[model samples]
Target: MTKTLTIRRPDDWHLHLRDGDMLRAVLPHTSRDFARAIIMPNLVPPVVTGDDARAYRDRIMAALPADHDFTPLMTLYLTENTDPDDVAAAHADGLIAAVKLYPAGATTNSASGVTDFTRVAPVLERMAQIGLPLCTHGEVTDPEIDIFDREAVFIDRVLDPMRRNHPGLRVVMEHITTSNAVDYVKAHDTGLAATITTHHLVINRNHILAGGIRPHYYCLPVAKRETHRLALRAAATSGDPRFFLGTDSAPHTDANKLLPCGCAGCFTAPNTLPILAEVFEQENALDRLEGFTSLNGPAFYGLPANDATLTLVRETPEIPAQIDTPEGPVTVFDPGMPLNWTV
Candidate 1:
């Protein structure tokens, strides 16, 4: 039985709209569903300063369809040499909504990210003083840290210290994928918030390796064990205002993705909401879905819930197995078969 559903429109708190060709290719897929998104800043040069962020925002705006009401909330890319005064100036001028800290070598296109937290202390201190949120790609790039435990270690080693150093600073643990991340965010819910990805809520590391190597299912802070997946579902639909939708709908070209060392990301925007609905149904937490999707994120960011409304019906929607883009055809992440819900 398909029932019509209505909820306050949701925003994607974390998104990767890669530049140039890829930007044009995937903009519509996201804009069609989300009212606004906290755009990632990891381009080749990266949006490190206010000027760079403003210019990048303009390019994203020009790329969107004229009818699209999507607002691309910009974030400054933090580097080891980032200037303290500049971060304060940008926040004061309203040039950026948040500052993203991608530890050097953490993920895709993060080669220019900060190498040591201590080196960027001045910048971090300034952001805290002016009330800017430090959104993080929570992971350790150290060769010794087990990939699966990176997020937890990051919380213990990096985030915990930074939070202690700047007690009033707002921080968002973006695209949280593990049970440990949920526990950490909940433990610090008074001062921390996390954005849960649709893929994490529905799949585990096993799904990525199921039957055969599935490139489309791989992503950074890679999916974890079955227990983590269940915990993510519980946190996502638990009606907690600290857990919200981030999608993290990162995209990569087919050539790069199918290579020997396939790039890490999942181009799931096309099926993101559908996948979330399926997960909610499995947990029988559909009744609490709206609050997680629409209410939690805005509360975390101190923004108002979207005034518009969106509907996600439970009818089976046959999305394509792959969608052709300018870069090349990209495989979509599907959970075994056609999802029994659509948005």
Candidate 2:
């Protein structure tokens, strides 16, 4: 029998399609490529309850193009006041796919995030019992901590203790940028896994500061050293089911990004899969792409693998060097770069 290479359609486990106009502008890109996505909850006010999350999910559906099969899996924003029983009920009801935990003052529109882990123990305990995965921002907000050290530091200081305290908990270390995160999750290896973003696999800190201050490349878990990037590439291409695709494809308006105090996130949803193929090809790991992009995520989340198929042809194509929006033109991570494959 001849071995066939079939492209399995993938779901984005982590994503940030902001509400209203921004959501409208970016939803099409992801919907066009992904069958489903676990949508982020860091909106302006944030989606904090089952009703809020469900309502927000409705809005995303309303914003989506009617003919597309893209399903937005909503998640509630975990705050210090989040009720555990309510959290469990929501997850059990299938109103939410997961619960997002953002340390207070972490990223865009996360002002209402949990200020201390202790404050949210009730909710965390409930989520653990209900089998609801806790997706994390994985950063320490303490200004004294080195920006590059935040993710690893959080794992050591916060995540480790929390995981140990609740052995039943399921954690997804979202947007992992350092080897520490990879090591920690693998060591824990029970119901814990991590997400590998398309940008971190391809770039390092130098890419952000080499030429100038590149606001477009700025993101939470800010890109790390070259060695870390290498580790990320290795981990992503290592054929590990523990690691999977989560574009974290957050889009910010040009004005918001170019400001002195710009927001943090990368808008890679439009070019996520195409770039993943190129990276895997470069690593000579094209064979493992499906597992990382499609299988691993759903399997970890206890969902069935996607039966639908997608195609990625080896072809040279051009992407805009930047995307022009009502706010302004923002640079794209893989923009205009020659790619070996596109989906």
Candidate 3:
């Protein structure tokens, strides 16, 4: 059996580092492993303009530990009233990596998201003209649609139409959870890709509902059936450049997570690497781990692969039950099995 493996330091294609105290507590975990991360802009007010992205990037840099050498590749949260000029300038200045699209009410703090897709046509056109990528939350917020079916439905109802209209636009289907999403990406010849989260690769909907309501296991675009989990694992470990790692490691205090209507997210930043190593090892596809976690994302975003490397040793690493933050203790995601690799 292989004992030690080393790969280029990875980048997170999708990440949520909430502002203020939560940001201070959680930023270190990701910085320790990832060389750069596409920071999500769905804050309380949301980062909607070029100025907003720049200011948020400054806060991320201020919060990062002095010893950690990490870069925050920022993004602007797209809204109905968003200025296409601001987005274009941000990308032109290299101030932001992508523009995020969240359907209104789709997930946490998404009340400010786009309700009318057509209203954002000008922004999408400008993005296409400049080669900027649009990162989508990938779920429709229709109350009638079953949560489990939202992702697949979004492809048909929203995403396909948008792509068909703006053929030149590049899109990243963020934190995708189904085989339908996999097939969609495969069907597309170019200008389309998907990001698979570390948590989604391990847990299915049953993980959240089986014995009892496991709030820590619950997340937006909630984990799907076992077959879907298998498909995500296959795609992630397939060495396909179109699929890559995006640990949607969102943090919610234990207090809020256990509420009657708890928030949706899994705090997986700290242990993503070790768990990914175990999953790839089980599939006997360790050779492809580097591409999924490190290389593919940069290629899609037009950035260079990280020069430094991370080595994982074949030994179990202790995972804390929870991480204590000033606001409250945030539970870390448990893969529900022994992980034999540690970075």
Provide the lowest-lDDT 10-residue window in model 3. Answer: 312-321
Model 2, which residues run further than 4 Å from truth? Answer: 1-5, 324-330, 335-337
Deviation in angstroms for 219 in model 1? 0.6
Poorly placed runs, candidate 3 (over 4 Å): none
Evaluated against the true structure, the overall lDDT of model 2 is 0.85
Tens digits of per-residue lDDT for model 3, 24-125: 999999999999999999998999999999999999999999999999999999999999999999999999999999999999999999999999999999
Quantify all predictions' global Cα lDDT against the true fold.
Answer: 0.86, 0.85, 0.95
Query: What's the residue-level lDDT of 152 in candidate 1?
Result: 88
Per-prediction TM-score: 0.96, 0.96, 0.99
Per-residue error for 92 in candidate 1, Å, reads 2.0
Per-residue lDDT over 269-326 for candidate 1, one digit per residue giving the tens place of the 0 to 100 score: 8888788787787788887878888888888787888999989886888787777778
- Predict model 3's lDDT versus the native: 0.95
Stretches off by above 4 angstroms in model 1 are none
lDDT of 1 at 320: 79
User: How are the candidates ranked when ordered by lDDT, highest leading?
Assistant: 3, 1, 2
Residue pairs in steric clash, candidate 1?
A: none
